[model samples]
Target: MSERPDISTPEHIRQLVDAFYGKVRVDPMLGGIFNGVIQDRWPEHLAKMYTFWGTVLIGEQSYQGAPFRPHKDLPVQQEHFDRWLVLFRSTVGGSFQGPVAELALTNAERMAAMFMERIGFYRDHPERFIQ
Candidate 1:
């Protein structure tokens, strides 16, 4: 049997979230979108993100929030979502180096693509994100 790699840690997940937001805060492509949203609540937001990613990568159910539902209320467009994927991929690529990292980023990319596609379709239809 193939052994599952011991490739994830809470600290690693924290690093990824911190590094990703650090990049996002500076990226001209995505910075404006996150500019005012994360100013004072960056620490809390980061904590939530860490919990979310840690749960995803390490099976720790520390995350508690409905992120997508709030995102639906935001002023984000399809382009914003697409750019989020680009920035997220770039963030992961810049910070991690390993097979696990590769797998994680690949999965993240696929999920983001699927999310954007679905959201885009829903936005175009206005009948799905509601249901």
Candidate 2:
């Protein structure tokens, strides 16, 4: 496989966020859930995502919102989180390489685990997940 470009700038973060969400918008498994909440405010949501990823992949402090609050009320299930990780991993792997990409994947994995645990997926079905 060809090597992916390094994610070293805000532009790269923006690219990853935009590309990833674009796929999410069209994904059969995740589209409905995301569109149900995002509705017509895709631009705002994408902007926030860019800021979130920027802060995550770099030291940018543009994002300042609760990451898990929006998801708390969503009717998301374990399948949804799994699909999200699948898409996210694909997006990062397709677009980036190097330490930043590794960090991005690590952060995403942690976020997924935390969200799953908080949503009771881990507690309810401890055998399904690996700690």
Lowest summed lDDT window (length 10), candidate 2:
122-131
Q: If scored against the real structure, what TM-score would every candidate get?
A: 0.75, 0.88
Off by over 4 Å in 2: 121-131
For residues 71-119, write the lDDT of model 2, one tens digit per residue: 7557777898889999999999987889999999999989988987776
Candidate 1 TM-score over all chains jointly:
0.75
Query: Which digits, one per residue and each the tens of the lDDT, describe model 1 over residues 1-131?
Result: 54433338898788788888887888776787677766788888899989988777778999997756645545666677677777777766666667777777777777666666666666788865544
Q: Considering summed lDDT, which 10 consecutive residues are worst modelled in model 1?
A: 1-10
The lDDT per prediction is 0.73, 0.87
Q: lDDT, candidate 2, residue 61? A: 89
lDDT of 2: 0.87
